[model samples]
Target: MKKLALAAGVAVSLVLGVQPGSALAAPTSVVLAASQASWDQKLAVAVKFGLGDDFALVELPDRDFVIGIWDHVKDDPEHVEVRVAAETAFAAAPEDTDQLSYEFIITEVYAAFDRDVERERQEAEAKRQSDLARSAAAASIDVVADAALLNGSDADFVRLIWERVADDAKWPKVKAAARAARDGADSDRTAFIAAGMAAAARQDIDDRIAADEAKTEAEKALERARASKKLAANRIGMPVTDELLNLPDRDFIIRVWNFTPDGSEVQAAAIAATRSLDPVVWKAYIDTGLHAAVERDIQIALERKYQADRALAQQIKATATKNKDLNLVYWTDKALAGTPTQLDDFLRAGQYDLDLSTSFGAGEVLPSWSNTVAWTGGIVNVKPICCTLTGPELGVRNEPGHTGSTSLMYSGLDNNTTKSYAYLKSMALSRITVKSSTRLSYWIYPQSNTVRPEVKPANSTCVAIDLLFSDGKNLRDSLLKDTKGNRAHPAFQCNKVTVGKWNEIVVPLGALAGKKVTTLVVGYDQPGNTGGYRGLIDDIKIAD
Candidate 1:
């Protein structure tokens, strides 16, 4: 079914970010007080503050309500901090007529409020340490003493030592001789003394630098850890207690919540997203805070999912709509369509309808009976059941219209005793007087391994359909490629049977010759193949 749609890209944007002044940006206290108001009112507030997409409900395993905001602002850490602070504060505030009362603030709220503040404090500590390192480097050198050392020292070390001596005016040195001794001592002791000073100073400075680096690094690591933790915590899992991702399984995802004592809002959101996701199994990523201030935000996320699914469905629908010749959407539970198979009905999400519906042999009992439809794509598969033998009739063969050749292989073909008797039945070859534009179509799907007498392959046996027709004498058989019989048409090809969904078979009327008198047959045929290799058949149509 097609839906009246909004641009999918726009809907996705809304889920990713909440605009300024949107409801998501509102002080938690304000939202708590006004939650009783209509959804439109809250949405207006969200848009006003540009926080519509930033907020969502955080469900506790024990079923408690908590609000979560995407407070990761790269350039505006302050704003992020402020929002967290407001949400924390509002949690503690008592509801007033239009806002939360100041006196209602509590210890728990204060603890949450301090979270952002602590982050800032950690960041500030990092900045302070960086500044300290720069200051230490700048203060270590003396310019004037350095200049004197250049002229006085015999070596570069001499200059450095002399500068130290010059700084010590109380040193006992007499005029030129004192300068000479100092200069001489400058070279001799310079290396040893300078090495000692550097070693000593660097010990303390290195420690400070290391501490600062560690603090900054630790803060960054913490931020990353926090984000990873939040992502894990916020994930929406399939509502089913078992593994929902398992392929080829029919399941359902249901989301039940409390929204407006009546739970209507929760129901609406679930219906919308479910229709959009249209998953094989019923899996629900539910926000339990249906009555909370964040319900609207949850709805936004669901709406986004819906729009995405709608866009994809619309594309598939367009293929059908544009091709008016496709008057039907053949539906079936079989993973892949086989020849000689029948098509059932389809479920529409919004618009368009299915003309036929079908169920395969066995295991059809698990289907859902809700007003909604069940279509599992990923999890369901077709498993092949091997040959088995039972007592009785031993072997009996029924062949359709081959005259003597039909009964020739009677003894060669086995019923596999344990399995039901197998036979081929083609539509009676009746001649039509005139060439009419006719469409021959059918739907087919794969069956499960639990089902008996499916294709075993090892015995060169698998279920297949063969369609043969002739306009006068010009004869065309089931797509030669898909037919399991002779290799008359090499170019004709179809996928080898595996676990998958059903597909449709359509032959345009133009493919047939204009001459009258013809024959048509739909049935399974085994050339050299034997044993119980049979395919299921249902709904067959020939329409003009």
Candidate 2:
């Protein structure tokens, strides 16, 4: 009966819109053969009770209703008599037959509860499997993405930079960036690979380039060190150590020469080469040797000097002698001049003969003949070219003159100071130049009016050829003679002359009719005014 009722009960659960008390209508021809039946009989009975194969207690709570199954018998005509008898016995209440019917109902209800619980467990298991599979698949995708990027950078590109190294943990993060670069925006696949590699190796690449450059520079320094040692050895006939090579080329060579015992042509050549590097060192070395070679050089240099000044002192003297160009002989004796006083008094004689005819040069100026300053240590201590000793400065320019390539040029500028003088004073002659009746002749170009007579006079201011006479005496005697009444000299003042054109100014030495002159001075007297005090004086000479 329990089987029969459950079969019919499950079939009624499949019916759409069947309420708790609703009956499933079946055909009157269908019949149940027995009370307790097999599964096949129960199936057939359920079909005959008007139920489909699709029935489940889990989906419909009303499918477990006892009334639904009771309806199976209520609607069946073929089993109506037995169904009626069973119903009357179930309704009478306190008999074993009635309890049997209740037990059947309890079995059906418990069976439905069991089916619903089992169904819930199966559904939960399926969902669990689905969630696990989804997580595993996502992990696989992450691993694949990160591995691809790492492989792009030479297999070893990825590393655990932190102390805690779980490659699996970092995979997702690296994969995210690489995947964005790879599949998101970048169109080129190779770009992803290159970018990954560079990002990984940036620090390493910079360090390598720096190391290579440092190594190359070290190699070059070693090569230079070797070259310096070789140069000192081959050139100076001595070996230079690595320490000495640190010195510059000039200083290094000088150190080597200072130690060299004998200076031969090899040593000389080495020193000469260093002259471009250090002239003072070369001069110290080469100038120490005294031989025919050096004397000949001196004579050749003087031979090219102002033609007339070279006349008498052209040949070097073995001893102090007269009849030489007194000025030339004095300066030429620098090699053996002992002291300046001896050279000045080289001639133990009377006044200088005033051989102005021979004192003037012919044609062109010599490179050796420059009287740009006051004389000292031969002529090397000549004074400034031209000056006013105040506000204005004088410029000296050299061009073709009456005789030589050199001439005196006084640039014009105003001097606001009182008693300002612009003069070019010749160095003291070793001997005196006697001129009393002689005529002082020179070519002059006075471009401005500073030298005209209106400004030049005996007392106030003038532009003149100034002179100083030494009386051919010693320093004290010369100063004493200048202090006493016996001393006398004059300046040949400038007269009215053409502007911008060369004019000859011949001054008769009647003012100094008896004095012998030693120092010849030229340029402006103390004329106070705006001085573009410009002029050129050349071919200065004295003749009877």
Candidate 3:
């Protein structure tokens, strides 16, 4: 009777929804079959249609609901009842409008149901794999820990085991086991490893401490040696100290030359002892040889203290010249640990064009000769192409080999006028210079002679040639040649006068030989002239 009632209802639905032979009503038939099919078959159909999770659940709530729906359509025996139930469920849904809506909903619901099942399966598999990984990690930790405990005394073994494990969290146990092994019996291998590790660490620390102590001792010895140096004032009235010998630290070496009063070796000894630490002190003994300034015997005892300063300088120069990087030398009292510098070969003065390719940015001014702080190592006799001026006129003054002070100004008319001078504001001579008989050379051509008229006082109109010392003092003075004594020269005369021609002037190196030459400043004295005196100056060269 129930089956009969269901058939009657299905028939009524067909009457309301499908025409006797309409193609549009075919979907309605499919929906009814889906709703009434067996749970398994309905699930299969749902997967094919890609129904959502909730829709699949909505279709098959329980086993019995499936059975009831199936029973209503079972009479057909062609499984038509399943399609009828699906069609009915779709008709009942909120979104259904056309009779075919039920068929579409049933198809979608079954698809989503299949996807949900597959997703669950994948999740379970992932969890299983994760558990397996954790188990493997835990097992590895056990193996590492056992290895550490068994051979804790051997630092290499322990270190090797940890390398295999490579787990930071497990380090504590390994460390503890190692410590225990170190404390164990001497015969224990684990303890031996621990001892080795400790010994290595101790050795490293000891080495550093020794190095620091040596440095400290060297510094102290240098201070004492410098204090005892003999200084003499040269003709330029600058104090020049005698040469200091440089030596490196070594176990045993013959550093001090000519120990005996007769320039013969007396006793050779290792350099490790404090008494023979520095060579500078011993050089003093050599200076006042066998017949010492104080006691002859004292000089003999101090022969080993002398170090060869000149030899050291030569060595330093050799090494520095080979260095590809920008090499700069600075004077220091510190004792060199290796070869010393030989400054003589590197101290020649010549016009130098500063090579500045290594710097990072542009617009960087190249250093000119005479700037003491220009290159490394205190200035010797070198000519700068132009001064990198300071103050407001820094970038403004572009002429090479120019030096000037704010106090002196140049008159554009004559080179001698100092009223408004054209100067390289920041340039200055180094503290060290060459002071001997020197012939100054430069080409000077005046564009005008407005300020210091052609005939000015001989002494007053003279161009001061100063061999500036490092301590801010000039050493020489020379006047422009008096071709016509007491008569001033015109601005346009080149060959005979100091104007309009590129005249080659020669200066003697002897002028800068005895005294240290830091800078060479060429300018006029007081009553200086101002602008409008134009001089085309070039090629200021210095040579022996």
Please list the Cα RMSD from the true structure of every candidate, rounded to 1 decimal place.
32.2, 61.5, 42.4
- The per-model lDDT (C-alpha) reads 0.28, 0.36, 0.31
Q: Is candidate 2 or candidate 3 better by lDDT?
A: 2
Comparing 1 and 2 on TM-score, the stronger one: 2
Sort by TM-score, top down from the best: 2, 3, 1
Q: Say what the RMSD of model 1 is.
A: 32.2
Q: Name the lDDT value of residue 138 in candidate 3.
A: 24
Instruction: Please provide TM-scores, in order, for all candidate models, with all chains considered together.
Output: 0.20, 0.27, 0.23
lDDT of 1 at 197: 27
Candidate 3 local lDDT, 463-524, one digit each (tens): 32233332122333212232233211121122243443334444454533533333334432
Q: 56 in model 2: Cα distance from truth in Å?
A: 99
Q: C-alpha displacement of 399 in model 1, angstroms?
A: 23
Q: What is the per-residue lDDT of model 1 for residues 313-388, given as tens digits with 9 covering 90 to 100? A: 3443443232221222122222113221121111121112222222222322111111110111100111123324
Q: So what's the TM-score on candidate 2?
A: 0.27
What overall lDDT, based on C-alpha atoms, would model 1 receive against the true structure?
0.28
